[model samples]
Target: MGGSATRSAAREVILTLVVAAILIAAMPLLIGTYTLTVLVIYGMLGLSLGLIWGFGGILCFGQAAFFGLGAYIYAISAVNIGESTLPMILAVLLTAGFALLLGAMMFYGRLTDVYLGVITLVVTLILFKFINSTAGPQYVIGEARLGGFNGIPGFQTLNVPGDPGAYIWGDALYYVCAVALVIVFLLVTWLLRSSFGRIAVGIRENETRMALMGYDVAARKTVLFAIGAAIAGLAGALFASWAEIVTPTLFSLGQSAEIIIWCIVGGLGTRLGPVVGAAGLAYLEFVLGQQSMIDNTLIMGLVLVIFVLFLPRGLVPAIASLWQGSVGAFGRRRPVRRMRRARHG
Candidate 1:
């Protein structure tokens, strides 16, 4: 049983890597930079939620808070520093630090699951309102003006590392984002199969049991939460570069809700599931946005309801189930056919 399980896992990993390679190789030739860049950003956002909610069993409703925090940090820092290299690093670090502090407060306080979600939502709202109110010139952080509701614009965009002057845009930016997504995906996959990951999942499954086993449940949860935030921060930084602007909308309730929807729709728990979900739905939304007659929000809401009612495990899991069922049936039939042939002979 152990050997079989190992083989199955190995096969799954190889298949995931191969598929990722093929997609990366084909995306440059098939899609424009704008479309590809947006997909990459969405993919990272989905991954952030998928890691926290899917694996850590922490449903963070304020994931957008970290995302916005990262964007604002990057924008402000880049504007002040006149280069993106340091600002990008600061964005990720600050976001992770904030998550670590927030998670520590929540986990150590022994907040219940519902309360955790509520607190995250409230935190996001507070940030949104505060940032939205910062329309005055006094809200400036060095060279970067917090354009209040209008958002901070004209910040330095991401440039090549070391050179600082040469910008990565267009097709080059697409490749960078694509490569980043692939790396993040592979890292998350490896972590999920690691001992730390198993322990985290164990805590999610039965916190009491994991606690009794001498695991520091709160600490583990905090680390996972921070990791998720850092991933979201990376996404946010990329988004700011892609759009050449950062807005409080990044911290809006709507964005938070959408992130949750992506994770749920894509089939959470697996590494690639959220990416698949985020990209598929985002593209759908984009297409829907083009049609003057169709209300995109209504369509999305309906799709969510349909998925929850009929396909709770989500698209990836549903397809996996069908594949397994087909394989099982085929195997069973082969044995019966072999037995019949032997008897007839």
Candidate 2:
């Protein structure tokens, strides 16, 4: 039974990869570069949140904190360094380190889920306000000034790893973002199939039980949180490069809420659900923002409510469940038909 289950999981993994490949191949042909770039960033943010909240059972409401931190770090460092390579690395590490510290404080305190969520939200808000107030020249970090609400602009954009002269932008930037998405997706998929991933999920499902089973629950959760933060940071770094600016708005409550909404609407606990949700909703938002006929917020809220009421399991998971049910029904019918033939013979 264990071997059979393992084989089934392997098959699912291969199937997922094939589907991803097909979708990615079709993206450039279907979507314009600008929209695709935004979608890619949103997808990465969703993926990061999905990993922690869905798989690790961490309800982080301040995910945008890490996202903004990464963007700011990248922008500042890139401005000073005259290239993106080192700054990109710095962003990921700094964000992950911050997550580690934050996670340790909460996990070690044994904070309830409610408290955890509140703390995260508060943290995000604090960052937003603090960054917004840093408009004075005294708020400078080396060559990069914290322009407060105005944001830091004219920073160095991303270039190739070795050759700083080969700036990545336009169509090339779009493809880079697409490729990054694929790599991160595959990496997370692989992680989910590993022992650490299984243990993390176990911790999520039952922390006490995992502790009794000799696992360091707090440490594991901290690690998972750090990983998620790192992914968000990567997304933020990319966003900074794409926009050539890092703003306090990146840490705004709306940004954090949108990340959660994307995860919930996409399908909590599923690998690709959040990505799908983020991309789909971001495109919808883009379209809605372009027109002045309707109240976009009202429409979005109504849509979210409808999804929560009608499709609680989310789009991807609901479709997956239906597909599995049909397959199961067909398999059962095949066995019954075989039995009938044998009896008749």
Candidate 3:
């Protein structure tokens, strides 16, 4: 049964990836590359939080800190190295390393959920303020200037491996982002089906029980937290490539709140929920940006409230439930119709 279940999960992941590939190929015809690229980036960001909060039950309010750090790291490295390939790798690794240190401190120190959230939030604020203060010329990492709130712009964007002249922009960037998002999604799905992932979920569900079962709950949580940070860092690097700038605003509380809102509105405990929520809400915000009539934050708040009150399970799970109900109803009616036909005959 376990083997069969694993096979079934693998098949589902393959099917999902096939569909994603088709969409990635076809979406350019429907939406502008710039908009789609941003959506893809936000989707990855949402997935990062989803993996930790939804699956690992680790609510991190400082996810934006990792995101901003990744962007800044990539920007600084790209400026110094004059190539994007190594910089992008550095972005992910350094961000993950930071998360590992922070997570180890928090988990090993036995911080409760509330305190964990608070510490993460405080850490993010510190990063935000510190970055914002780096306006002076002295705040230089190698050749790259911190630039304070003005941001680091004009850094070399993503390029072909071993070729810095061939920059990836416009539709090519979109495709790259789409492919990266799909790959990350598949990896996260696979992780959730793994033994380690199952243990993480178990720890999430009942930490005391898992600890009593001889599991190193703290270590597992720390590892999972670092993994989430790595994913977020990757998304941040992508965003920097697309925008050509890294700024302090990336670590702002508002950015962090939006990430949480995306997960909540999309549906917690489900992989696709955060992605869908982030894309949908982000597109809505884009539209709202073109018009000054409605405030984006206000609309987001209302949407969050509505989901919490009426659709608490989130859009994905709620839709799945409705679909299952309709299918079951049809199956039941089909049996009744067969019975009626037999009696009539």
Clash pairs, model 3 backbone: none
TM-score of 1: 0.92
lDDT, candidate 2, 1-345, per-residue tens: 989857876786687668777876788788888778979999999999999998888999999999999999999999899988999999999999999999999998898689999999998988999999999999999998999999999988999997878999988898888888888887887787777887887887788999999999999899999999999999999999998888899999889989988988998888788999999999999889999999988878887899889988688767765675678954444444322221111
The local distance difference test score of model 2 is 0.87
Tens-digit lDDT string for candidate 1 (67-142): 9999999999999998889998999999999999999999999886899999999999999999999999899888
Q: Highest lDDT: which candidate?
A: 3
Against the true structure, whose TM-score is highest? 3
Worst 10 residues of 2 by lDDT: 336-345
Worst 10 residues of 3 by lDDT: 336-345
Query: On a 0 to 100 scale, what is the lDDT of residue 50 in model 1?
Result: 90
Candidate 3 is scored at a TM of: 0.94
lDDT of each: 0.86, 0.87, 0.89
Q: Alpha carbon lDDT of residue 192, candidate 2?
A: 74
Q: What order do candidates take by lDDT, descending?
A: 3, 2, 1
Q: Candidate 1: which stretches are off by over 4 Å?
A: 1-14, 28-30, 329-345
